[model samples]
Each structure stands twice: as structure tokens, then as C-alpha cells.
Target: MNQLPEDPCMQEIQRLRADYEAKRARSNLDSAGDRRCIRLADIPGTISGDILRLKQNLPDSVDHGDHEIIGDKVRPILNPPPPPELDDDSEELDTILASLPIVDVDSSKRFVKKGKYKSEIRNLLECEG
Candidate 1:
């Protein structure tokens, strides 16, 4: 999950979220205080006109790129590379097994039943001698 995408553009987009979050944090820090707020009622006429003009200048929403182009662009996303053969932080099985502490069990040691549990015996028929 920590690895970047193959496409540089995607990598850039992925970074944008974190970058924007950080910038937002810094902006908040810089503007900390009630004094920094711009009240809508307090905004003078000229700045408000400029804001209106900017809003008017914005183009109407239009259909994006052609479907074919869109499909092509999303193909990589739709079909991603197979997951890594092994995770980056994962140790090799051999090394992991080697690192594990060995527990030696004595072959001669045998478990004996005790307590309330006991083996059941079947009655055998007695033969006339």
C-alpha cells in the first residue's frame, strides 16, 4: 500500500491529498483567530463585484473527454497489476523459520493418564480349563 502507482500522474494525484491536507493545516495555523474571518456582511462592494465577475467567468459544465479516451485513461485503474509476489516488509520463509526459537522435546517423555480419567477395559470370556 505504501508503494507508488506505475503512472507518474497517479502518483502525483495520490500525493495531492496529503499535500492539500498539510497546506490546509498550515493555512489554519497561519490564520488562527476570529480576526482572520471575512464576514459576508462586512465585504465591501468592489471585492464582492470582483468575486461575482470571477464566478460569471467560470465556464458552464461540459461533457468530459470522449468515451473511448475515458476508457483508455481508466484501463490501468480498471485492471491493476497483480499484487506483489511478496510484501516488501515480509521476511523470507527460510529466515523466519530460522529466527524462531527451537523447542527440544525428549523422545523418552511419555504422557500418562491420571486424575478422574482412566482407560476402560472390556470383560473377556473365561474358558473351561
Candidate 2:
């Protein structure tokens, strides 16, 4: 009678395959990671739940872990701070205007030549630099 050989390599491969299968199964079921999110049983939290369920599940070579629940509950949409609050942009404008230093305008106009305007601007830029 010929006895089948117990290959260590095959045994190791089987062990790894089993381990992967187990983790994949666990990932599909378990979602209680960091945050406690309300999971819908009907819906799959993961995109590839079906693939994971299949016997030929892809190998976890890419270190692709299951996405954990982000939040405890879905927040209710608030009726965004009254419409008036949004419409009242004048307050912001007023605040900006108030922050600006008041400048006094001299009614007297000393007309400088058009050519002088460029020189004056260049001089002002040079001074600033």
C-alpha cells in the first residue's frame, strides 16, 4: 500500500490559505473597529462583500483591511441657520469697513503731468521695496 506523502510546503500553504479565509470571513462580519457606527444589516458596509463571500476570495497581499464605521449615528440635516442669517452678508461688509482705517480726502487737486504719474508710481514702488 502506498501512503500519501505529508509535504510540509503543502501543509504550510493550506495553513496560510485557511488563515486568510478566516480573516476574510471575520472582516465581512466584524465592523466594530475604532468608531461604533450604525451598520445596516441589509446593506454591505464594504464594496467587495460579495467577492469576500465567494470561495475564491482574493488574497490579502495588498494589506486591504475592511473599512471601519466612521460615526456612531447619522446626523439629522438641520434647516441651515435661518435664511436671514445667510442673507445678512452686510454685517460682514460692515465689519470689514469698520476694520479699515479712515482716510481723509483733500479737496485740493494739484494736477501733476501725465508723465509724472509713472515716475511717481516707480518712486513709490522703489520706496516700498
Candidate 3:
């Protein structure tokens, strides 16, 4: 009697079958309703308003105090301040200075008298050596 040997096509079918089974198992493990959506709806609109008010009142570097929920349980939440705005005049100056290269003006202009000054300096250095 002859038996069928495992081939590339059979391997591919087995891989697909395993993937389908894994997906089915995951679907079974998932909750009936997504908790994230439910949690978002449960959060009070007043809390969002408080966050906006806190942001408007404080500078970027400033730290807002922890939020405390009073009642049955005490839950603390931290809120950070918004980023500060850059001043227009200082920002413009920074941009302009960033574009320029540093150079020594006196050294560059010291040899302005034709090519004579450069040649003289070279000769003086040669004699000294």
C-alpha cells in the first residue's frame, strides 16, 4: 500500500487551517462588548471641562495638581500644562543668527592692499625659517 507524502500545497493548507483556528479562539476569548467604548462613555463631561480649564490657566512648565475624585473611592489623575508660545521678536532674531557663519573680519581684510602684503608676509616667514 502507498501513502501520500506531505507536499508544499499540503503545508500551505495546514498553515491556513491553523491561522483560522487561532482567529476563532481569539474571538471566543474577546468580551461581548468592547470595554474601551463603555469606559469612554462612563467618563463625566465635567472632567473634560476641568482639563480644558486647567490647560488654559497654566504655563507649559507649570504642573497642575493631581485630580481627586471624592466619594466611595479616591482616584488621583495628573494633568500637565500646555506648551508656552515663543515671542515673535526673539524667534525672528534666532532665525536670522542661525543662518550666518562666524568669521574674523580683521584677519580677512588685513591683506586688502593688492597681492603685495601676502607675498611680503610669505617672504618674511621664509627668511625666519
Assess each prediction's global lDDT (C-alpha) against the native: 0.32, 0.39, 0.37
Q: Candidate 1, residue 80: CA error in Å?
A: 52
After superposition, the stretches of candidate 2 with alpha carbons farther than 4 Å from their true spots are: 1-5, 29-129
6-114: candidate 2 lDDT, tens digit per residue: 7666567667777876767755344334322222222244433433344332233312332222222223223323223244322224433443355554322222332
Q: Residues 1-129, candidate 1: write the lDDT tens digits.
A: 233357676667667766766655544223323322221112334433332223211111112211111211211133334444664553335533443356564332323432221111111111211
Tens digit per residue, CA lDDT, model 3, 1-129 = 222336666567667666766655544223333221111112334533333323112122213233333222224344424435665432224433343455454432233432223445456457757
lDDT of 3 at 68: 39
RMSD in angstroms, all models? Answer: 27.8, 27.7, 26.1
Clashing pairs in 2: none
| TM-score against truth, every candidate | 0.21, 0.21, 0.20
The lowest-lDDT stretch of 10 consecutive residues in candidate 1 is 117-126
Which portions of model 1 show Cα errors greater than 4 Å? 1-4, 29-129
User: Candidate 2: how many backbone clashes?
Assistant: 0
Clash pairs for candidate 3? none
**Which residue window of length 10 is worst by lDDT in model 3?**
34-43
